[model samples]
Each structure stands twice: as structure tokens, then as C-alpha cells.
Target: MRIGVIGGGAIGLLLASLLKQTGYSPVLYVRTEAQKNEINEKGILYLPGEITSYVYAEHIKDLSQMDIYFICVKQHDICSVNSRLSGLSGTVIYLQNGMGHVDMLHNMTEEQTIVLGTCEHGAKKRDQRTVIHTGKGKINLALYNGNAALLTRYKEVLNDKRFPVEQVADWGIMLIDKLMINIVINPITALFQVKNGELLTNTHLHKLAKVVCSEACAVLEVNEQQQWKRITYIIEQTKENDSSMKEDIALGRQSEVEGILGYVLKKTSHQSSVIHFLYLSIKALEEKRG
Candidate 1:
């Protein structure tokens, strides 16, 4: 199968490496020619054992042919590539972090199959050609506007022991669950400049996280207690790993705060003080870093 993995970020490199390890020569579509050339020349360096996998690397605009395309870009950057993705004949799976990109899928061609997914794996791009797999996690996928059979077929083709893939019945619930996790973990970690485990180790941060989680659950109409348990469990699993928002702040790149907390603000009629505070806090950080 001709699999096209979009973006050269941590998630894209990790997915490309997994496909290569699974015996598929996946084409990795990066934003810059420099990244494409560098990856093409050096191949993808998957860390923790120093395994390298050689795969096809092409510029994002050069994306034309592929049986399946995995959109691994950030939610905020989805607009830049949505036009090209909407016209593809093959299946396009969006593996973005938040629910912000869901609206763009409505404009895709009727004939094209669209899949939405939430990634839980902790990945960090060490360099253009190096991706460190920090923690193992499953990818939850749901059909947004696609054939049900395609989900079953791709689940078999893409599933592996190292990188597992699971199917979900409802895309809304799948994304909401991921957003809930992000809303609690991301802003606190970014603001405090700490790892995922620090939320648990530091009592003060843990209390703040619970408050943010409760506000998010209230807006999304989900159970706060149940979601807090899940959030704590995720923090435990990815204790040593850095949250994506933290990395973005450290690197001075625009984070997905708008997609996470900003989305919550838009959903509710009543004001969410905690959520509003976090939403503005991250935006302020972005400006300061810029």
C-alpha cells in the first residue's frame, strides 16, 4: 500500500517509522524541501534502540498518489493543507490532537473516505530525521465520512504490536475524550514547564489540573470524576514524557491552546473562568515567546 504520512513533526516521523518497520514503504510528506531532502538522505532515526528506516520523503505540495494519507499536522495548521486533502481519491486519516479540524472534513468530496483519529503515543522530534518514541499508546480511529469496511481493512493493515490501532463507533466521543485529556494536561504543563508526571507529584499542580478538568467536563457535559481518573491514569502512563504543549512553548512555536480550551469556550453558554484563564494564558505565552 502507498501510505502517505503528512507533516515532519514527531507524530509524522513516528508513524512513518512504524510503517517502515511493519514492511511498508510509506512516503513521508514534509513542509520544507530541506526536511524532505534531509530525511531522504539520512532516513528516519527511531530512537530508544537507534533503529533507522529508509522511506520516501517528498515535499507537502508533491503529495499526489497514495492509497492512504495520514494527516499528522497540528490542529492549528490544518487549514494550510486541507484543500489538497479534500480532493484526494484515497482514504485520508486525520490524526490531529483536538476537535478543531473536524469542521474541515465536512467539505471533503463525497467519494473520498475520511477517518478521524486521536493519537496517545508520546513522541518527540529530536531532529529532522530523528524521532524519539517516549511512550507506547494506542491510536483510536473513527469514521467521520467514510466506508465502514475501510476501517476494518485498515485496522488489519496498520495494526502492529508496537503501534496498535483501534476503531471507535463515534468520532465525537473519541475526540472529546482526547480533548479532555489535553485540556487538563497541556496548559498546566506548559505554564509550569514540567513533565506529565509533575502534575501528580506536585500537589498544587494536581489541584489546578482537577479544577481545569472539572470546568472542561462541565462545558462538554461529561462526568468530571470519571474523566479525572482517566487523566490521572494517562499522566501515570506518560509520566516521564513531556506534553506537546510544553515542547511547543520551549521551542517557541504556536501551541494548540485554541483548539483545546478555545473550543470549550465556544461550546458553553455560561462563562468558564478556569478554562478562559488557561486559554488566555497560553495565548499570552505565545505572544511573549514570539
Candidate 2:
């Protein structure tokens, strides 16, 4: 299968490398001429052993013919490429962080098959052509619209021992399940400037996370205890790692607070003061940084 990965960042490179490892032809859509040239020359170099393999890289303006295109960019960056994506007709799997991109998907061309994916994999980009696999994780997938049989085909192509993939019938549940995790962890860690483990070790922050999770559950109508366990498990699994939200704040880049919290706020009529305050706090940080 010919698979193309958009957004040559951490997840993009990781996906490209994994696909190549599994004997699939994966092309990467790079942002810069330099990155495209580098990968086309030296291939994508991934760690911990500096494993290198070749893959094709093209400018976003230059579209390639492929069976699938993985949108591995952050939610906030999706709009920049949405128009380009509309022109392509193929299976476009979006691996965004939250439910925010769900609405944006509605605007895409109907000729394309839209697949929603929630990735738990932990990865960091060391450079333009290198991505470090921080922790092994699963890729939970669902078909929001289009051909349902595509899920079976994708499962066969994407599933591997290193990065297992699963397809669920309920797309809404799959999205909310992942959103609940993001709601609890991303805001607290970014605001306090702590690692994932700190949320569990610090009593005050731990309780605060519980409050936030409770508020989200109240609004979303989900099981609180089950969601809390998922939060803590993810924290323990990626304890030492800094969250993507915190990284965005540190780098002076925009975070996905809007997608994580804003989406829930928009969906529900119930007022969640805690989530509202945190959402405002993140926006304030963005303004201050600006």
C-alpha cells in the first residue's frame, strides 16, 4: 500500500519510519525544502539506535498518489492544510489530539474517506529527520464517515507488534475517551510546568486533576472512576515526559487548549467553572507569551 504522511513532525516521522519498517511505501509531506532534501538524501533517522531508512518527501503543494494520507499534524495546524486536503481523494486518516478537528473534518471533500484516529504513542522529534520513540502506545481508530470496510483494510496495514492499532465501532466514544485524558492532564501540567508524574505525586495537583476530571465527566456524561484510572495510568506510563501542551507553551507556540476544553464547553450547556478557568488561564498564557 502506498501511504503518505502529512506534517513532518514527531508523529509524522515516527509513522513514516514504522510503515517503512513493515514493508510499506510511506511518503512524507515535508514543510521546508531543507527537510525534504535532507530526508530524500539521508532518509529518516530514528532512535535509540539511530536506525535510518529512506522515504520520499514532497512539498505540500506537490501532491502524491497514494492509497492513504495520515494527517499527523496538531489540531491547531490542521486548518493551514485543510484546503489542500480537500483537493485530494483518498483515505485521509486524521490523528489529531482532541475532538476539535471533528468539525473541521465536515468541511472536507465528500469524495475522500475520513477516518478518525486517537494515538496514545509517545514520540519526540530530535530534529527535522529524527524522532525518538519515547514510549510504545496503541492507535485507536474509528470511521466517522465513509466506507466502514476501510477500517478492516487499515487494521491489516497499520497494525504491527511495536505499534498496535484497533478499530472501534463507536467514534464518539473513542473521541471522548481520549479527550477526557487530555482535559485532565494537559492543562494542569502546562500551567504548573511539571512532568506527567508530578500530577500523581503532588497531592494538591492530584486533587485538582480529580476535580477537573469530575467536571468533564459531569458535562460529558461519562464514568468518573473509569476515566480517572485512565488518566493515572497514562500519567504513570509517560511519567517522565513533558506534555505536548507544556512543550507548546515553552516553545512559544499555540497549544490545543481550545480543542481539549473548548470543544466540551461548546458541546454542553452545563457550566464547568474549573474547566472554564483553566481554559482562560491557558489563553492568558498565550496572550502573555505573544
Candidate 3:
């Protein structure tokens, strides 16, 4: 099967490279001509310093044709990109952070299949056309079509040795859990301009993180896992790399706090919810920076 990648960011490139290894044809589209030139020269380059094998492929600047489209843009940019890729009738896999943005994309194009995906794998752009593999994790998929076979077919693209995928019902709720994972950690790291591991030493802040995590669980319906469960691994991962939000804030760009934290408050209605604080605090923090 052929796949069209709508972004050349770390996650988008990684997914394209992985699909290339799995015997599927993939094309990567970027927003800029500079990135397009850089990627075409480097092809599908991945530094798998921490992981096993990586697949490599070339990027296409001009859109040709495709069977599937993977929308890997930031949560805020999905609307604009979907507007451009309106002709493709293929499935669009959203490898974005947080939840609830899918509905906005659906409004843009109804004929296309919008697949929701969460990547546990950590990737950071080292430079134009270069991305470093900071960590490894499975990708969970939620497809719009009710057909389990389509889910299975999507999984086949990532079913290889390096990147296994899991399919689940209620992809929106699944993304809620992923949003919780990003919210507490990404913003704190960005605001502090510190690595996650370094922030863990601050007991008060660490406790605050747990508090937000608890609020997110309540909002997203994720049962509490444990103190040293999945979070511990992330704490260690944060030691080496700054978070995505950290990178965004360091570069003076806006954060996805709305998609990550604000999504919870918006969905919960804040009528009788503790997560209302998260929304207020994050907004206040962003406003102060302004």
C-alpha cells in the first residue's frame, strides 16, 4: 500500500521510514521548500542510537497521488494542512499530541479516513532533515472506520521488529490518556526550560506533577497506574532530552498546552471539576510570558 505523509517533522519522518522498511511505498510532504530540499538530499535519515534498525526513504516536495495520508502536523496546524490535502481519499493518520482535535479535522474532509495515532517513541529534530531518536515506544492506533480489518491493515505498516503497534476501540479516549502524559510533563519542562529528570528533584514540583496527573486521569478516565510505573521510565527519558514543549518554548513558539491540558477542561465542562485549575493556571502562565 502507498502512504502520503503530510509533514516532515520527526514523528512524520519516523513513520515514513518505518513504513518503507515494511514494504509499503511512502511519500513525505513538508511545509517549506528548504526542508523539502534538505530531506531529499538526506533521504530518510534516522539516528537509531537507542533503538534497533531503522528504515530509510526519500521525501517528495510536490504532491502526486496516494492511498493513505498520515497527518503528523502539530495539533494546532491540522486544520490548515487538512485543507491542503483535501483531494486525497486515503486514510489520514493523525500522529498528533492530545485529543479532541480530530473533530476539527473531520470537518475539513469527510470522505478521508482519519486515523488517530499516539506514538510512545520520542523523537527530536536535530536539524533540518535530521531527527534524533531519543526514546522507543509502541504506537497505539484508533481508526475512524469500524472495520477491524482496516485497523489490522494499518497495524501491518508498523508491525515489524522495531515498531509494533496496538489497535484499540475509543481512540479518542485513548488519546485522552496520551494527552495527560504530555500535559503535565511538556509544559513544566517548557516553562522551566529544564529536562524532566532534573525537575524530578524538586519535591514540590514533582508533587504538583502528580496532582496534575491525577486531575488528567479523572478527566480522561485512566485508572491510576502506580508511582514507579510508566511515569518512572519517562522521568529517566527526560534526563537526556528537553521535552517537545521545552523545545517549542525555548524557540519562543506557542505551546500545545491547549491541546494537551486545555482539552481536558474543555471536555469536562469544569462545572464541578478540579482540572479547571489546570486550564486556568496554564492560561495564566502563557499570558504572563506575553
Q: Please, what are the lDDT tens digits per residue for candidate 3 over residues 73-143?
A: 78888777766666756666778887757667646455456678888888887676666777777788887
User: Candidate 2's error at 228, in angstroms?
Assistant: 0.6
RMSD of 3: 3.7
lDDT of 1 by residue, 1-290 (tens): 88999999999999999889989889999999999999889899999889999988999988886888899999887887877665568888999877778876667887778899998888999999999998888888899886889878998878989779999999999999899999999999998899999999999998899889988897899999899999999999988889999989989999988788888888986674888887888899999999
Cα lDDT for residue 212, candidate 2: 94
Positional deviation of residue 164's Cα in model 2 after best superposition, in angstroms: 1.8
Preferred candidate (lDDT higher): 2 or 3: 2
TM-score against truth, every candidate: 0.97, 0.95, 0.83
Model 3: lDDT equals 0.69
Candidate of highest lDDT:
1
Tens-place lDDT digits, model 2, residues 122-219: 88888889999998888888887788887688887678896589988888999999999899989899999999899999999999999999999988
Off by more than 4 A, model 1: none
Candidate 2 vs candidate 3, TM-score winner: 2
Give the lowest summed-lDDT range of ten residues in model 2: 81-90
